[model samples]
Target chain A: MAIESIDQTSSHLKLSNPDSTTLVIHLTDDWRTTSHLAAFENVCQGLETMPSLNKVLFDASGLTGWDSKLLTFVLKVRGWCDDRKVDLALEGLPGGVQRLLHLALAVPERQGARKDAERQPFFPRVGEKALQVYASAGEMLAFLGSACVAFGQLLKGKASFRRSDLMLFVQESGVQAFGIVSLVSILVGLIFAFIGAIQLKTFGAQIYVADLVGIAMVRVMGAVMAGIIMAGRTGANYAAQLGTMQVNEEIDALQTLGISPMEFLVLPRMMALILMMPLLCVYADIMGILGGLIVGVTMLDLNPVVYLNETKASFNMTNLWIGLIYSAMFGVIIALSGCLRGIQCGRSASAVGDATTSAVVTGIVSIIIATAILTVIFSILNV
Target chain B: MNEAEPQIVVKDLDMGYGSFILIRNLNFIVNKGDIFIIMGGSGCGKSTLLKLLVGLKEPLSGQVFYDGTSFWEAGPEEQKRIMRRFGILYQSGALWSSMTLAENVAIPLEQYTSMTRAEIQDLVSLKLALVGLAGFEDFYPSEISGGMRKRAGLARAMALDPDILFFDEPSAGLDPVSARLLDDLILELRDSLGTTFVVVTHELGSIFAIGNNSVYLDVQTRTMTASGDPNRLLAESKDPTVRAFLTRGAEGK
Candidate 1:
């Protein structure tokens, strides 16, 4: 090889003499979109002509497009040069391209051109940040809308609801929850009656414990407490079950086969809890009233007939309906938060655990907030 | 027939996980009825290359061709139509754990074809029969052996009678006997259907047995070393790495 004319294609790589200690190769072809192997072979073939070369420069000036194939070619050439102790310099690459090459090739270099250029922050880049905001809000809103739609469409699928899944959710959310709800509601009612007894005794009206417990249980406390407990238990269960399935690629497999995972997984759980929670809340109310009755009979020396009569007189239909509405709202929030966490879970077993914890936390927080808001509204409306 | 009419052609493919390049400039073609194997060392982007071929991931750059038509050039409906002509058997079989064997086989049939329940069941049974699992329709994936699950995956892959099938490491975790059995099944499929296959594997037994043509990836260089009939390459290649890899197992024997 002898001296040849040196030509400048661009600032990146200038074609120089083959005999010179330095040679530059510029890959300004459709190597990424064209036949990748042929494009790669072209570079290899072009470089093979140089028998003696100490240093070489690579310019990606006209490399309008590139891909993994082209990257592999560059890496291959780098290896070849390395084997022969040739120092290859790269220039005029885009920052993104330079970053990718550095990461892929595991090589780092800096030049004056790239130093002063301001690049966007990795986290706050408009694309992913916008998606994060949109995704979080969208995921929350999406569960509400999609869960409702999927609930209606569940029965239309080829796999009819296995009576087992329904029975399982019921047994878990209803039968298992009964003892806890009853115990808590009774304690709450007794606490209310004890306080009312002490206050009413000051005015010689201690028998009003019957009125206090009856109104409170039927109006708010019974439903709100039951809803909160269910939010912790059933909502967390839904998230853990579906989140595990999602991480294991079961949800993706369903989508590929045109089965909506929402319909397959979430709708049944949501519908079962929604249909069951209010009834459970009503049961809690009855148990709470019994606790109040015990307190009134023991503490205030009120007779059973008189206590029952005061309870019946004080319990209004509007109060009962208020409890029902609040329980229903709590059910929706629990189901929504659970399903959202489940579907949005990351692809790992640990993520399933995280989703379960998140579901419980979100479910409990939302229920408490919702109960407080509804209680205020009910008081303002005198319901 | 035009010699250029490949069943699938990948041109200048670049795929990565957002700034980390996995495979770059991967170009290869599978002619009609050809058994093309992509071989590389572990983590040399074989699986990523398979994903790009099947449209699971968008390449950072480059194009894939099926029958001379650009894959990305097609509309969604057209891409779906093209998808119907091919099938995929993922590394782990990727079968639906919740579904029974019969239901798994019926997925593509039920989704792409307008077959009634009876017709779908019949087709599912036929596919299962072809994969030597005619009587195991009611068994869930967990209840079956690994070999049986791979067979079921194959049955599902072939449900629509696709002209092309792609498998990502068909014998990865199998016992030698089971892997050999699967390899025999692959040969049987190729012989009977004349379907084009694109497999990504470094299994020498499979490469020697069924690979009509192959591409070898050099891990150190991160590019293709050689591509041709493996037997010929084994006999005539001048590349040191290619020779070393191909002969390493032989040296052990």
Candidate 2:
């Protein structure tokens, strides 16, 4: 009879000899990951000395934990002793261990064997592998191309928005956004005019204060700042709206019905944003200039005629066009990022949130990057 | 004597993702105007097989022919042309949530046809009527119940009066009443329109009610073990997995 104490801390082994046979074998369930293969291999080698030992009982009840690689070693040892016609009886397999053994039914024994098998790879041959790589690359390229084409289709359908959908987006995205943009633009202009007046008075050149605020607000600052704010506000909203639809299977529903999700979903939103951005930029321009005019007329004690004339003269068609174009670019970028992220979203609530966050981040980053690049390019090209 | 060509022919189909082989050598045919159900447990490639049949996901190895034309092997435009003949009711019905019932149904009409708004509206109403959701045209998907949403989706799918209709778990995620109603609708559509139907589901009630023919996918072997009438297969099949699944309801009782 083989009796053993079930120690809670130290390791314990239980060897049950089912058959009547005299066998000498070292049995230890103190199976650490480090000593796993060595201990199992030592048991196999020790069996070589006992010729009469046709049966060996190895118990694993006391081993609280073991990794896959260690269990794999035990299976290999079992296989080795099995081939020698030695009945290696494994006793006290934990319930968890039994489940794991059933789970990973197939695994390689030797590293060399795995290496040899991996060297001459199966499943997908070289040609098929190359084809798969090419196919995936082609798929990615096709997706990008489709995205561009989708954007183009949206642009072409700029005039094709359903009166209702366009109006809804306009009311929600543009009209609702106006109050925020106007308030911010006015505050920005006030801050700039105040700063310019204070700095210019020290140089006794306070007259130029009106000109500085006028040129900056009308030319670039108002439109660019407004665009950035919209990118965060309305842009993120577009992404969230469409992204939610994508995750919720609405977009897929459209596709299944022989309707293009992009054409139906993105085109309408893009059209609305495109039409709204330029109008919003113009509104911001007016508000920003008006804010600065208040400071110039009251605080700076400047004549309305002089200030108005300077504001008119300091800004021109070129500056106006630059602001318009960049703001439009920013608007397009926002819509593009939002819709793209939305379509690319995975099927989970978290994925929709991720898309919304990425849409805002990408929209803002792209706007800044494009603005900087366009600034340098426009300056160099004298646009 | 119906002598029309088989609506769908899947020969030696192998569908899967990456290194994980989902199913292999799946061969079956759906006769014209037949209601065919594909039944299997969860994660048994039932959806993937449905995708392949509808030409949504290409098979890793094999061909799926729709009305004798290899839809996937054909060019994109040709594929779209072939796709026009088949209507699909995706699982969850996948109706356009933003659009109202009428607009959602009119989407296909708006896309591939030059049908006037009046004509499209008439067609939409007709489809809605067929699915028992008549006069609910202005209702947004969110405004309706799940049963109505599924009916709305069915209305949308039937917009083109397609020759073949594919239902991905049509009765899934529905109450017994709604599921039975959906099954009845499937039979009604087959009776009235004579359209071929392919449904992917494990609902035994729907299977018994609607399936004129079917295929059972075994998870262990990762292949179709039986393809025929459910009643015969359940009573006669020797495969334990097939028996386990088929008699699952009996076991519960």
Top-lDDT structure, candidate number? 1
- Give the CAPRI class of candidate 1: incorrect
Question: Which runs of model 2 end up more than 4 angstroms from their true locations?
Answer: A1-144, A147-163, B249-253
Top-DockQ candidate index: 2
Off by over 4 Å in 1: A1-211, A297-309, A372-383, B1-12, B30-34, B52-56, B61-88, B98-140, B144-147, B159-164, B194-196, B213-253
Give the distance in Å from residue B118's predicted Cα in candidate 2 to where it truly belongs. Answer: 3.8
- Provide per-model DockQ scores: 0.13, 0.42
lDDT of prediction 2: 0.76
lDDT of each: 0.78, 0.76
